[model samples]
Target: MELIEVADAVQLGVERMGVGPPVLLIGGLGMPSQIWELSGLTAALVDAGFSVIAYNTRGVAPSTATEPPYSVDKLASDAEHLLEACGITEALVVGYSLGCYTAQCLVRRRPDMVTGAVFLAGLQPSPIGALVGQMELDLIGRLGEIPAQVRVFEQLMTTLSPAMLQDPETVSIWRQLLADGDSLWSDRKGLHGQLAASFEWIMNEEPHPEHLAQISAPVLVLAFEHDVFFPPRTSRETAQQIPNSQFKQIDGAAHGGLFSNETNVVETIAQFCADQRHRLDGGGSRYASP
Candidate 1:
């Protein structure tokens, strides 16, 4: 991993591999670039002949945190700068969960830089989601840091499919893996910063109509069948807001499908990107450079 300065004193750690059409991967809230590798998506994408660029977002280790009160728009700006620094004039962008909100902001803010986008475990504005963010911030303010075990339990309970939870072996494995958190999520302050930003964005800044419709790039919103946070209905609604966006639901998968249903998610993403490249070659839409 190399640290690239994206802004004044703000360096984002990035990993690049393979060579073909460039695909920028923006991870979820407090997610480090390494999760892509852990999910097997990075290697799969590399083997499938695409240049993969993944990075640890600001506030994550090796990346300058700067101050907090960050917004999704700010995260989107970081992504834009990262791409520009890499000399990628345009590329396919992929965002997972909170990363989906960032990707949406990026597509709208800088259409020229994004050829197409994929929102994995997509996000749509929800009163409930906003409320949850507020609740998290409130709890942090009142109780200090939430215990790691409690956080892990909440994560597993919310993200795993009901079927997966029912499987004792699967549940046990996940329990162990999550209990031993990775370096990427070790910074409590960074995670709280992200939580604050999410609360602010969802409550105040998320576009209602005109903003999403302004996005001109072809988009694919991939939804998981059992995602409590972003169910198919929510993902489809988000897709409806964006022009020319496609929504596909993955059966038997939950919010954590990116890992649990790795093969399907990887195949779907690879196919969508490949199709976009083909479209660009055929003098298709405005996906080509101006």
Candidate 2:
């Protein structure tokens, strides 16, 4: 793990693994790249023949601060530069939550640098999405702008299934992980700045539904059935907007379900990015967002 200087003030924290087709992973809000390894996703993707590149999203340590107007486009550019620094011109993208937003920005803003993508717990540019997302942000802030490790663990637990949270071992493991992760990216000021940028984008921006039609690359949208912030219905709507894109709503999860069921999620991603026909298989029936 090392920090790559993208510009004078824009050094990004990057972690690379495996030695095959490059796969860039962009994580969601408050998630450092460490979650990928902790969830076994890094190993799964590597075993499936992929060079996984996970980076700390802006506001996390080593990555420079978001100057002003922390737009999704800026995060996309940071991703592009991170890839370039690693000497990779193009790669498949896998994103979760806010990471999904960043992935969408990457494909639209720099299509030439992306091949295929998998967006999990994705958000649409709708009032509901914005509202839910805002609610999440507000809740987090109320918990404290720089949350305690236990608070982080508690917050994440709320977004997972009861079955997952019921396991004491699982809780202990993730609690330690939360503690470990805080050490890496717990710069409160930077985090607040990133959230500020996210707020701006959510309020001022509209969903780019038209851009979906123009995207030539294949895409797979994975939505958690119980995700309140970004529901499966929205992912279904997003998939329809993109020609030939696949959509699936897996059971046994909520917003943070992917990590809770890492094995299933990793396999889903591997198959999708590999162009397998069954990539779109094994999901719940759909429901429209209310």
lDDT of 2 by residue, 1-290 (tens): 68887655778788888766777899987678888887777888778766788998877886766553366777788888787778776688998877887898889887877778888886564465566456546766687544465456655555667676788887777666566545555366556655665666667663467877887878888887767667777668768988858888887787787677533777788777666322222221111111
TM-score of 1: 0.91
- Model 1 poorest ten-residue lDDT run: 281-290
User: Quick one: best TM-score, which candidate?
Assistant: 1
Runs with alpha carbons beyond 4 Å of true place in candidate 2: 66-69, 125-154, 165-186, 276-290
TM-score, prediction 2: 0.81
User: Relative to the unseen true structure, what is the Cα RMSD of model 2?
Assistant: 7.9
Models 1 onward score TM values of 0.91, 0.81
Q: Among all windows of ten consecutive residues in candidate 2, which has the lowest summed lDDT?
A: 281-290
Model 1: which residue pairs collide?
none
Error of 2 at 141 (Å): 8.9
On lDDT, the leading prediction is 1
Tens digit per residue, CA lDDT, model 1, 1-290:
89998888788988988877788999887777888998888887788767789998888887777666677888899999988888777788999988888888888788887889998885675566676677677777888666677768877886688888999998899988777653564366667777777787777747567888888889998998877777788778878988888989998887789887533888888888887875433232222111
Query: Model 1 scores what on Cα lDDT?
Result: 0.79
